[model samples]
Target: MIYSEKENVKSLIEMSLKVIRMYDWLLDLYVLDFFVDDHWEKLPKTWRDSFRDMDPQHLGEILSNKPPKQLLPLSFLALIKSVDALSIPRQNTYKPAHKIDLKNLDNCKNHPRLKNLFLKHVKLKKRHEISMMADVVVDTAMQTGCNAVIDFGSGLGHLVRVLAYRDDLYAAGIECQRQLTEEARKLDLELEYTAKKHISPEAASKLHRPLHFNITLSCYSQLVKLPLPETMMNYGLIGLHPCGDLGPLLLKHFVESEHVKFICVVGCCYMKLSCEGKQQGYPMSDYVNRLDSKLSFPSREIACHAIEVYCERLMKGNYKDLKIHAYRAALERILVEHDPKLRHAPVRSIKHSDSMTFENYCSLALERIKLPLPTSPSVWSRGYHDLQQWRRVVVVYTLRLALAPLVETVVLLDRMLYVMEKGMSCEIRPVFDPKLSPRNHIIIARR
Candidate 1:
C-alpha cells in the first residue's frame, strides 16, 4: 500500500539523515586509491575480498572489449550489494498521485487543438519531453480550477504557448536569459499565424491570443521586483526542470506568494546547489539542519545530474568508453603530482572524442587547465601504466555510482520537507518515464 504523505516525508527525512552520516566516505575517491596501501581495509571485508579475488585480465577484457552479456567485475557486484544494504527500500516505490487519462482526453474536441499545437511546438523546439509533460500539467490545472499559469525559467516558452492556446486560460513565461525569451517570442508569433490559417477565425479567437503569453526576461532573484500581469495573479506555478538552487527558490516563492495556488516542478542539476553559508539548498528543513553533522559539498556534487543514466548503462554492460572515468582520475593524479600546491584546484572538464586515448586525454586536460605538457612522452606512458595496474579503480568508481540515487533522494526530500513543514499539501511523484527522462521526479504542492 502507498504510504500517507506524512509517513512518506517522515521516512524520507530518516533516509536523508542516514545518507548525511555516511556522506564523506561515499565521495572520497582517494580511499580506494591503489597507490595508497592498506586503504582497502577501510572497506568492508566482502568488498575487499571481491577486489582481491577479481581477475585483472578479466576486468581489462571487459573494459577493452564488449561482452556478450551484462558482465561486471566481482568488485562492482560486491559494491552494489554493499550500497543496497544501506538503501531506503521505499524511495523508488512511490507512484504518481494522479495518472494521465489520454484515452478520455483524446475523445474531447479540444484534444485536436492541443495535439496540433503540441506537435508544432515539438517541431520548432525539438524537445518531445516538454510536450508530454505539458499534457499532464494542463490536465492537472484544469482539474484544480486554475485559470492561469506562470512558468518559471520557462526556457523557450513551450509550456507557456501550450497553456495560452487552451480555451479560457491565460499564460506567461519568466525566463532569465534574454536570447531565449526573444526566440520564444518569435516562435509565439509564428505559432499564432499558423493557428489562424488552419482553424476558423472564431475558433482561433476563442483560444487566448498568442501574444498574451508574456515571455519576460529577468533573473529569478529579481522576480519580486517585477510586476505580475493581472491575468497571471492567482495562477499555477510550474517549471519543467528548474536546475539546482532554482528548485528550492521556486518552493520558497510558492509559499510566500499569496497569488500562487498550485505548483509543479521537476528539478535537475543537484551538484550546482549553493551549499555554503545561510543560502545552502540542502537541509532547508529545520529538522535536518539541527542534526549534529551538516551536509558536505563533496556529497552534494555526487548527487548531480546524469548519475542515473551512468548506473543504468553500467548495470546493462553498455561499455561505451567507460574507461573515461579512469582516464580522468589518472589525469587528476598527474595534475596533483606535478604541482603539489595545486592539489585542491578544481579540474575543469575537457570534452574529447570517444576514440581519444589516455595519453590524448591527459594532454587535452593539461592544456585545458593551462598546465605545461610533460617534457617527455615517458610521463604519459607511466600514467597509462599506473592506470592499467590499478584496474580496481573502475570498480571503486562503480561503487561510488551506486550512492548517486541516495544522494539525490536526500536533496529532493529536503525540498519536500521544506514545503510540508509549512503545513502545505505536497507529493513527490514519478511524473515522467525514467527511461525517457532520467530526471523524472516532480514535486507537486498546493494549499
Candidate 2:
C-alpha cells in the first residue's frame, strides 16, 4: 500500500509538471509576441493555436486571409496588435516631486522599520519609488473625491505621510506590527520637522491641515471581523503588496462593503493564502468546490513538483535575489520583455525558512526526480554560504518583483468589475514601472 501510494504521488507530480510546462509555454509566447516583438509568425503552430484560444484578438486578423487550419505569422501580428491596444501598459509616470526625501535620517529615531528599511534598501535618491507609490495612491484618492485614505499593512507611514501632506486627504495606516507603527509615528515627527524647516511661514500655514495619522498593530485578518472606524468605510482603501492570503481578503471586504468608494490592493505569495470565510483553497479552490465540492490545496504531489521546478531554476545558476517586491517588479519586467510562461515560477517563501545544509536541501530536491546526486554531499556542502541578512534583503526584493504584476492585475480587475457591478463608471491604468518597485503597478480607477 505504501509503495502504491508513493508511486501515485510520483505520477501526480509528473502530471503537474506537464501542466506547468504547458502554462509556461503559453506565458512565454505572450511575452515573446506582445511585449518584445510584434511579429507573431515566429511562434510555433501549437503556440499560435493556444494564443488563438486564450486571446483570439492577438492572432485572428493576421490569420484572417489564411485558413483556420493554417495560421500565419503576419496574421498573428494583427491579432496581437488588437490585443496590445486593449492591454494596459505597466509603466507610466505622474508628476515628479520638486523635492524628494522629505525626512532626514537623524530625525527618524522612532520609526525604526522605516529607517531600517529605507536605509537598507531605499537610498536618498532611489527612495523616490516609495514616495512615488504614495503619491499615486494619494492622487487616485483625490480624483475619486475621497476625503480619507486607509492604508493596510502600512509599514512606516510611507503612504500615510504622503496623504497627510494633502490638506483635504486625511489618512490612517493599519499595521499589525506595533513596533513598526510606533517607529513610523516617530518618523512622522521628523517628517513634520523637515517640512517645517523647508516651508516658508505661508507654506507652513498651508500645511496646517491636521497631519493626523494613527497606527494600529493588529492582524488585518482580525480587523475585518471587528467594527473598524466608520471612516474606513468612507475612505479609499489601499494596500501595497499585501502578502499571501491577506490581499484577497481585502478584495472581499471591498467587494462586499457598500461604504468604500475605492479600494486599491496588490497581492503576492499565492501559496500562502489560507481558507477565508467561505473558500477551501486559493484561486481554483473556490471554483473547484463550487463545481463539485472537492475543494483543496494543490495536492501534495503538485506542491512537491512545484518545489522541484523552483529548486532546479535556482540551481541552474547562482543569482542574487532582489528585494521581494523589487524582484517581483523585475520579474514582471523580464516577463514583459522575455517570457510570461514562467510567471508562476516557484517562489521561495522568505517569510518562512528552516535550517538545512545546501547538500541536504539539494538531496531532498533531487529525490523528487528520482535522480542521483550529481556531486557528493560533502563536496556540495563546501561551497554553500547561507547569509541570513543578505537572504532577507534578496528575498523581499525578489518577492516584490515577482508579486507586483499578479497582485496589481487582480486588484485592478477587481476594481473594474466592482465599478461595473455597482453601476459606477471607472477606468484603471497602470501608473508606474513594475521594475522600480515590486508594488509598482498603480490602478488609476476613476469613477
Candidate 3:
C-alpha cells in the first residue's frame, strides 16, 4: 500500500535501524563471507547442507541456456523460494504513488521557438529517457519562478545547455573533472554557433546575448569556496545523476544557501559513499545522526547492488553468463590458499571476451594483480568444473542477491529524510522507467 511522504520516511528509518541492529550476522551473510572466509565449517549445518545439496548440472542446464524459462529441479527451486521469503517489502521505494508527466512541458508557454530548438538538439545527442528527464526539470524550474539554474556534477553540461537555451535563465555547471569540463565547454560553443545559424537573428537576439553558459572546474567538496553570480537572485539546483557524496552535499547546500529556491536530484553509486568522518554521505539529518542506536555501513559490494534491476531481470527469466561469479569465486579460493597477503587485494578488471575460457580468465586476473601464473593450469581447471564447488558458490551468491533490495531502500530513504528534517517540502518519485534507467528515483525538494 502507498504511504504519505512523512509516513514513508518514518517506516524506512525504522526498517534501516532494525537491519543495523543485526549488523554482525547481516555482514557475514550478505557479504558472502561464507565463501570468502576460511571458516566455512563454523556455519550452521543446515546452511552448509543447503549449498552442498544443490545440483550443479541442473543449475548449469537452467542458467546456461538462453531463451524460454526452464523449470528447475525441486531442490534448487526450494532454496530459492526460501530466500525470496526473506526479502523485505520494497514496494514503497520501488514504485511511487504518483505519476510524473513529461508531456506537461508542452503546455507551458515560454520561449516556444527556443524550447523547440533546445529539445531537437538534445534529442539527437542524448538517449530518450535522459531527454525526457531534462524536459521535466526545465518545466519545473520555469513554473517555480527560478531565474537561474546550477547543475551539480554536470558531466557534459547537457542539462545546463538546455536550461539556458529554453528560457532566459542564466545557467552554470559545476564539474569536478577538468577533462570533462573542457569537453563540455567545446560542445557548448559548437551548439551556440549551430543554434544561431539555424534560427532567425531576431529570435537569437531575444536569448541571453552571446548565448554562453559558465562551467566551473572545481571539486564539489569545495563548493562553499566557489563564487555564485551576484546578479542572479533566485537559483534552481539540478543534478541528472550526481554520484556518491555529491548527492547529499547538493541537498545540504540547497537548504543552507539563500539563493537556491528549488532542487531536483537523481543519485547513484551508493557504494562509493564515505560513512565515516565529517563528510559522511549517509545519515545526513541531525535526527538520524543523534539517535542512540548507531548505524553500520554495508560493504562496498552490498551497497553497490541495484535491487530494481535484479527484480526486472529475474522476472524476465534472463539468467545467462552467471558463471563469471563462480569463476571469480574459484580464483579467490586459490589466492587464499597460496598468497595470504594478496588474498584481499583488489584485482584490476580486464576485458572479458566471450570466447575466453575459465582458465584464461583466471590467468588474466592474476596477471593484472601482478601475481605469478599458476604452476598447473589443468589442476585449477578441474576445480572450476567440479560440480560440488560450482553449486556451493551459486547458492551463496543467491543469498546475497536476496538482501540487495533492503540495502538500496535504506540509502534512498536516507536522502529523502535528510531533506524533510530541514522543514522543506520534498518527495521521491520514479521519474524514468526502471527498464531504461535503473537509477530512476528522483528526489525533488523546494524551500
Candidate 4:
C-alpha cells in the first residue's frame, strides 16, 4: 500500500516518464502545423478515420468520458486511460478554507478581507485561489516551523495581505513589476485601514504589516542579497501562479537557502521555462534529465492549457469558438503560399466576437503580420478549403489536450524530484479547483 502522498507522487513521476517516452512522438506535433503541413494526413489513418466525422457533442463526450464507443479504437482508449491515470487529481487537498478553523485561536485572527472582499476587487477565481492557498500556506508553515512567508511574483499582494492578517505569521511580498508592487502596498494599506474598524484596538495593533520588495530575481546575486525582513530568522517562499520560470526560481531558492525552510508555489506558462540555459527550468531532477522522453516547446505550451476547463466546454458542446483553429490554419496555409517564409508567422490574437467573420479575422491577422489581404471575393472563396472540417480540427486538438495532464504531471514531478534530490521533502498538492484555476497544483517542499 503506497499510503504516503510523497511516495505516491514519486511513483506517479516514475510511471509518467515511462509513458511519456512511448508517446513523445505524438506530443511533438504542433497543432498550428495542421493545415500548412497536411497535419490531418500526418495523424495515424486509424486515429483520423475514428474521429473524422464525429460530432462536436460526441467528441466532447468521448474526451470527458460522458460515454464512449467502438467509435474510438481500443488501443487509443487504452492510451487515453494511461494518460488519465498519470494525472494528479485537481480537487483541493486541504479542506475548503471556509470550513477550516485555525488551530491557534489566540494568534490566528480571521481577517475580514479573507471572508469579505474589499469592494469585489478580486475576481471569483482569484478569491478562491488566495483564500485556499493562504490556508494551506499557514498549515504547512505551522507544520514545518516556518514563521514568515516571502511571496515571489506577488502581484497586488493579495496572498500577502491575507497572510499578513494572521498575527502569528509574518508575510512579505517580492514583485518584479514596480507598478504592481506600489499598487499592492496601497491596497494593503486600504485593507488594513478597513480591517482596523472591525476589530478591537488590541487586535488591530497585533496586525502584521507586510513589507513589499521590488526585486527581480534575474541573477543569483540578487537572490543571495535578499535581506531578512524585521529579524525573521526563518521564512518560506510562496507564489500564487508565478508565471514561467519564476516558480522554479522560487524552488531553486528554497533548496539553496537555509533561511527558506518551506515553499508552497504554483507555476504557469511552462513554455517560457529555459531548457538549455544555466538557469534551466526543465529536467530539474537527474531522473528526468536521463529519461529518453523530453519536453518540447510545443508540448510545454500544450501542457499549460486548462484541460479540465476545456473538457467542460467540450461537454457543453460550446463549439462556437472552434472555427478559429481551422481559420488560423487556413490562413497559415494561405500565408505560406504567398511567401514560404511566412510559415508559422506570428499573428496577434483577434478576439472572438459575434460580429466577426472568417474574412475579418484573416484581414486583421494579415494586417498585424504586415501581409497583403485578398480584395477579390473569388480569391477568398477558392483560397480556404473545407472550413466545414472544423470539427476535425477540434478532434485533433482535443486529442492533443488529452495528453496535456501527463505533460504537466511530468513537469511538476521533475520539480518535486529536484527538491527531493537536495535533501528536502516535496509533494504536489492540488490546492485549487482546476475548473476555477487550471494551474492548480501547488508544489510544496520543506527542509
TM-score of each: 0.79, 0.48, 0.74, 0.91
Q: What is the lDDT of residue 313 in candidate 3?
A: 49
Candidate 1: global Cα-lDDT? 0.62
Better of 1 and 4 by TM-score: 4
Per residue, candidate 1 scores C-alpha lDDT tens digits across 119-196 of 553553235456556665665676677777778887777777766764346777877777888888888778777666
**RMSD to truth, every model:** 5.5, 15.6, 6.2, 3.0
lDDT at 16, model 1: 51
- Candidate 4, residues 136-244, lDDT tens digits: the string is 8887887887788888888888888778875347888888899999998888788777776666678768878788889877754575676766646688888887878
Candidate 3 C-alpha lDDT tens digits along 1-447: 123466667765675556545433443453223345633454456656544564433433333223324444454454344333432333323322324455434321243433454444354425544555565566667667777777777767766766666545677787767787787778777766766765667766655421223444223445555565664557788887777777887888888877788888887787767777787887676666765434334533464555455544444544344455556666666777676776655765555455867668777877767887577867566545642354465555554544454555566666777777777877666666554565666777777
Reference-based lDDT, each prediction = 0.62, 0.43, 0.59, 0.76
Where model 2 places Cα greater than 4 Å from the true spot, the runs are: 1-88, 93-128, 166-168, 198-233, 274-415, 422-427, 444-447
User: Where is the poorest 10-residue window by lDDT in model 3?
Assistant: 209-218
Candidate 2 lDDT over 27-93, as tens digits, reads 3332212223332344465544444343222222222222344444553344333333322345564
Candidate 3 accuracy as TM-score: 0.74
Candidate 4 or 2, higher TM-score = 4
Greater-lDDT candidate between 1 and 3: 1
TM-score of 1: 0.79
